[model samples]
Target: MLGALLWGVVAASSLTLGALLALGRRWSDRVIGGVLAFGAGALISSVAFELSEEGTRTAGPLPVAIGLAVGALSFYLATRALERIGRRGGGGTAGLPLALGALLDGVPEQAVLGIGIASGEGVSIALLVAIFVSNLPEGIGSASDLLKAGRSRRVVLGLWLAVSVACALATIGGYGAAQVAGPGFSGVVDGFAAGALLVMLVDSMIPEAREKAGEIAGLLTVLGFAVGAGLSVLG
Candidate 1:
């Protein structure tokens, strides 16, 4: 449990780090977009090698398939709800959607981390790096938008800090839950995370990256995927 908690914190710390970096200086859209593209690619690798493959190995395909469909739908509905709320609230809260995305993405990702720990598989270095890498762009982009929208630095920092704490705690929660759940549960959890991540990538990250960075984003994404896949192979 302690190990899971610590690993979670380590993974989530990048959020704070990215927030600080964003607050410290202005980043060009190209740079931010490039980072997002790279992160998206890394996440894809994680979904493929870490989550889906492992889930299939652990508990076959049925539970994972159900989990995938459920998770994808859940994320879509939740994101739409958040968008509606943000629209009603006005443009002053432009950053809310991205922040919400980060929260939604973080929870299951870290939960799966905890599940891995409970399964005695130790920490997956590939997944950890992917999560950390992906979170950086989320923090940076969200904080930057919030600041541009005239939010106080304190509020932006506080929001991300809260998100970080919540995500970190999820790791502990997942670890505890996995201890009592059947083995099939881990596969479901893995599929759930993968589904959410896939939706997020398509819905927001990829399009945004392309809009900001142009065609170069594609190359960066492929490069990021290769790097993540290499790490998984080595691990």
Candidate 2:
């Protein structure tokens, strides 16, 4: 739990740093795209190797298959709901909805770390770190967007700080819940997280990178995937 909290601080702080960079208008698109790509890659690999296998191995292929399908559908609905949230603010807030998906992915996975330590699950520290590694680019993205909106640095930092705090609180809540839910129940939840994350990769990050950064963004996306996947295996 302490470790998770520390990670929360680090994640939030990283975003704050990104926001500062964005405020200066000196942050590179490639750097930002690379950041996003890195996170995307890490998340994808973790789902594929760690969570996917762990989930199916525990629940059996049948349940895992069902969970995966359900997860995807749930995320689809979530995406629409986020779109609604984005529409709520109109204009720039359209992308804001996607942050909910990011929160979903972040909090639960972080909770998994907290719960894992409490339960004596080996290597959970590494696992949470993987999730942390995935979150940095997202912070950069959020900060970059706010900067573009002509919001003051103070406002962007405040917004990101609030978002980061929510992430921490949500992680704590998720950790407590996952403890009671046990492996099978948590497996399903993890599956949902995986699906939601993929949606983000395709729906939010990919398009933004493709549009703003073009081929370089694409490369970074691959680099991010590779980084994520590699970390999953090694971390």
Candidate 3:
């Protein structure tokens, strides 16, 4: 449990780092987009190799399928709801969905970390690094937008900090769930996270990256995927 907590914190620490960077300087849309592309690539590898593969291996096809469907639907609905709320809250809260999006993304990833540890697989270096790298752009982009929307620095930083704590606890929760569940059940959990993550990439990460980076974003995404996959292979 302690190990899981530590690993979760290490992965999520990048959120704070990105927030700090956002507070320090205004980054160009192109730079932010490039970072988003790279992170999106890393997340793609994680979902494909780390989460989905392991999920299928642990439980087989049916559970993974069910988990995937549920995860995707849940995220879609939740994001839509957040968007509605943001719209109602006025232009100043445009970043609310983005901030919530980051939190939503982190939950499943951190939970998977705990699940892996509890399953006796220990920590997945590839997954951890992917989440960490992905989170930086999320934090920076979201924080910058929030600041632009007139959010105070304290509120922006506080939001990231709060989410960080939640993610750490989520890791512990996953570990506990594993203790009480079978391999098949844990596989479902893993699949669920992967499903949610993939949807998130499509819904926000990829689009946001593309909007900023243009055609070059594709190449950068591939590069990011290669880097993430290499790390997975090395690990």
Clashes of each: 0, 6, 0
Best by TM-score: 1
In model 2, the worst 10-residue window by lDDT is 91-100
TM-score of 1: 0.94
Model 1 C-alpha lDDT per residue in residues 9-93, reported as the tens digit of each score: 9999998888999999998889988988888888889889988998899888987887788778878998888777767877554
- Where in model 1 is the C-alpha error above 4 Å? none
List model 2 lDDT by residue over 1-235, tens digit each: 6655665565445544555556666566666666666666677776786667766765566655665667667667877765676568664553353455566666555555555555566435446666666666676776777666566778777876666777666555655675677666656656766766777777786677666666776666677667666666675
Candidate 3 has its poorest 10 consecutive residues by lDDT at 90-99
Q: Go through the candidates in order and give each one's C-alpha lDDT.
A: 0.85, 0.64, 0.82
Off by over 4 Å in 2: 1-4, 7-17, 61-75, 78-90, 94-98
Q: What is the C-alpha RMSD of each candidate to the true structure, in Å?
A: 1.6, 3.0, 1.6
Q: Best lDDT goes to which candidate?
A: 1
Which wins on TM-score, candidate 1 or candidate 3?
A: 1
Model 2 reaches what TM-score against the true structure? 0.80
Return the lDDT, model 3, position 58. Answer: 80
